[model samples]
Target chain A: MISPREILETINMISNENLDIRTVTLGISLRDCVHPDIEIASRQVYEKITRIACDLVKTGEEIERDFGIPIINKRIAVTPISIIGESSRGDMAQIALAMDRAAAELGVNFIGGYGALVHKGYTEGDRRLILSIPEVLARTKHVCASVNIATTKAGINMDAVAQMGFIIKQTAELTAESSSIGCAKLVVFANAPEDNPFMAGAFHGIGEPECVINVGVSGPGVVHSALKKLSPEADFSQVAELIKKTAFKITRMGQLVANEASRRLGIPFGVVDLSLAPTPVIGDSVAHILEQMGLEKCGTHGTTAALALLNDAVKKGGIMASSHVGGLSGAFIPVSEDAGMIDAVRCGALSLDKLEAMTCVCSVGLDMIPVPGDTSEHTISAIIADEAAIGVTNNKTTAVRIIPVQGKKAGDPVEFGGLLGGGVVMPVSNYSSSIFAQRGGRIPAPIHSLRN
Target chain B: MRAVITVIGTDKIGIIAGVSTILAEAGVNILDITQTTMQELFTMIMLVDISKAVVSFEHLSGRLSAKGDEMGLKIKIQHEDIFKSMHEI
Candidate 1:
């Protein structure tokens, strides 16, 4: 029989690899809280979100303390305001403001679903919600927006895609004085999954129950440690097996946490997103995992293949362990948050071009990347457009979270510290795409546009 | 007669393309193929019609096993109806 301490050590080894419960997102549907009267709807929205999400942070914290592991983010995702606002006679902006106030009052870091899901066709309310995003996000502190433009079964929604391309540009323009970073809080997706607990794409869909609890798990450090233990002479196949076993163990922990948390919270447990979500920690870098795999640096010739293997292994392990696995469950390469990634940029081992290529195989795109302060808004919009195109074309979820640090040059370090990580501002090629970004109409959906 | 070929074991180079080429050369028409790799483990399902082929199921399995030895892939050929019944649940 295995000794309990040894089993515990194995558990610790698995948990320590970038593995921790990623997010314990409480989904609260605000549709029932709506009223024909604007003030009543706003008040109801506030009361419902606050009531349902009341124990979210405390419960997550208690679980972390009991389990002796970290729960990185405690968040809330509400039903898409576009859907709720449709039944209300009040202004959609008022609903957004109320939602923002509720999130702040509840002390949650971010509240998702301040946008629309117009994959095939847009409703009047969705159009309003789309147009109101720039104002809603700019005026509010922590409201994140997302728009689903396509899905595999439904094909691609070109009209929504085109509108979103323009909306991103407009949102950037509206927030340009503040580094045009509001667009960073938005995501465009193809098959936008229902139970994704991560943001800024998380939203409570109409198909979901009244309330539920979902957890996202991360463990890049654990995977890296496993890879590090392998002999330097080990070939790629060995490396792949190690990653799969590590991911299997890590995902098992996630399933446990999700089940325990859901049981404690008295709500149905949602999926465990087996994403390698990184923090601002020194040892917990996905880039470091690649380096440990014998790459002189990340963002090189073998990067895509490496990412593909990691992504596939993670999904396979997680899917086998739980029927509830969902969310963006793959390796993440957020630039600013991972130390090895920061160093890679500082040493020129990584670049925007390589980052884009890697995103095709990873979970998210261009996340937390810091560009030069002086980079043009049009250029930022262009980058968002490019990333969105990849997600739409390939039928995956991708997002951009770029920060243009004020007065920061390309090589200078900006320390957001804590979970945001520190990073050297990366240089975007000086080439300007202002004219194209400024054209601002949606790129019509691909000919395969099917989802309505 | 229709047949279902199940490939299992480690994923290496040229599993599907190699097996498909042999089936094609034998005048087998593939109807559907699904494959997934988990770490070193690989699983594949191929639905094909071998009624026009010049060989029996045992003969085809024998040939595939020989090729499987060469490529380190395990290939099992079964009747399509039997496979469907076994897998329906």
Candidate 2:
């Protein structure tokens, strides 16, 4: 029999500390849904997703009831729509609507993979997908879009980066009535993970199985509570040990849930994404974990080092907990979705420059930041260029999901509501990067990539 | 299916009587139980086998929860695997 102390601890973590399985993402490959006729292809995409993911939400609920754990989201990730719609000749936005309808019918929070991969360069299909993003995102509420414009081996596609700047601005403009909410659903990535269970960057990669189950686990508050018990004099290694052990317990729960979900759904289990994803609610912010590490606030001088320790220890602890761990397995620092980060931004303790530096050691970069409304498209492009450069240089995945709130300036409070949260807009550099962005071409692969 | 049932609140009489009645009516057999007081609050942990429960797991859970609410206690029932997996490996 399990000891009472252990059982009580698990229950306390769930009821008080916000430990829960973040998402049970169903990855459905849409490679076979391609056709020259756009209508037929769209129908096939909708049918396949509905048929496969029909039980996703219901099953997740059942699991939640039995285990007494909250499964916050049941989402779907399909093959990148650019590849799925490559041979189709009509407006690709129709497919976006089809996916949105499927999500509505099946009752999933979001359906990702309205995306393209133009890391080296764009094909005609990729170009059309990129161009249609603003309208498609404006129209579809559940569909998400991501474009991979850079990779370590392929360097950066300066043209795609430049184009995305305009697309993001246009998305914001189209959804301006809703606080530029459309831009919140789109992410631009360098070295995007195919098996990511998180959004707005999740997509079922071409190499994945026809159908698989991936889980993303979250528990920043649990880590924060654990660290609060540590003595102030606890050294860095002790801190790391505590974090790693806490992460192990958390990921072990993730592994159990992933395996159970896979077994119940009769789908192959892919991986457990060991990420400390944050929510807008109090007590669940990753920044609080950093502050618990003795920093007065997040994004201080020692913030990067604190984040690096957390990210690496999480990965290290989680790796041994599960047999297969993949996806962006580290701490996420999305500004709008975290209360501590929102406070940090409002208090001026955190800056875009400092956030960018923090991303070098974290899982993803430049996530969920709302810039000034009048921020230029060229500057957005240059921002993507900088993030891409970091990913390429560091050989790690980095992404940008910045929203240029229409008619809003720095320090203005912006509310996106629900899980998206609200935060004050942060200012960006006024210096123009238009000329640099206009110089379009591919940035060649790094010299270190030749080792293969 | 086996599950862990926990009842916690102010240490007082009739808490055990109320919880045990609900479990007995649901045809659940308590396999093991331990009780203690922490921070001036009563905590009881019960390991129960519910495979032969007369009602659905959800229905039993709701009944137990409502009973807890009536008694001014925080009660929860979770599958045994959750505790084992987190603590064992």
The CA-based lDDT of model 2 is what? 0.94
Candidate 2 lDDT score at position A52: 92
lDDT of 2 by residue, A266-369 (tens): 99999999999999989999999999898998989999999999999999889999989988999999999999999999999999999999999999999999
Candidate 2 chain B worst ten-residue window by lDDT: B33-42
Candidate 1 residues lying further than 4 Å off, grouped into runs, are A8-11, A14-18, A87-91, A150-184, A373-378, A404-409, A429-452, B1-89
lDDT of 1 by residue, A1-452 (tens): 22223333443453345457778898888888767787888889889998888877887776654344567788989888888887767578888788889889888888898868876678988987888887877788778898876554554555565566566656656666665557667777666777789887899988889988888878888888878889999988888888877777667667766876788889898778888887767668888888887788887778778888888877876676665877788988888778888888888989999999998988878888877667776676667667877877776877666766656778887776556667788888798876776664446566665646
Give the TM-score of chain A, superposed on the true chain A, for all candidates in the order listed. 0.88, 0.99
Q: List, for all models, the DockQ compared with the true complex.
A: 0.01, 0.89
Per-residue lDDT, model 2, residue A300, is: 94
